[model samples]
Target: VYVETGTGELVPASLQRAQPALLEIPASLDAYLKSIGDKSRNMIRKARKLGYEFRRLTPEMLGQDIYEIRTSDPMRQGRPIP
Candidate 1:
């Protein structure tokens, strides 16, 4: 079953849980390829060549980077950002 936000479609019974929820992906073997910059993609390829499997951090971690960047802006701190 699949679900998406920002749409008014009815939920499928098969996907319905006993509690409120958001959609989630269980896992994927190629998870490391998602949400990556070009440098990280190259690093992943190198690691795989060396018999290492890279794991991508969750989008929540990416959100943390955005949040930190926003909060740390010099203009946001009430002074001219030099």
Candidate 2:
């Protein structure tokens, strides 16, 4: 699990409840869609139709966007956000 931590050094840790899943990023979005099943592909298409998009946050968006995203989940990783 490559979950990001604030700490710089690598430290060993364990979670009481963890369902680690491995995901592979295909060479292209079309290839990714092709790899998934019919249901998943449909769900992704639906989200796209709903105007949901995938974009990397720029430096200018890092502050507020990250804050909003992190705060939206009251509990993250293994602790409370606040």
Measured by lDDT, the strongest candidate is: 2
Q: Report the Cα lDDT for residue 44, model 2.
A: 86
Spell out the clash pairs found in candidate 2. none
Candidate 1 local lDDT, residue 29: 37
* Candidate 1, residue 22: lDDT: 78
User: Across residues 16-68, which tens digit of lDDT does each residue of candidate 2 receive?
Assistant: 58778988779997898788899998898899999999998776868888788
**Which pairs in model 1 have colliding backbones?**
none
CA RMSD (A), model 1: 12.2
Model 2 local distance difference test score: 0.83
Scored by CA lDDT, what does every candidate get? 0.70, 0.83
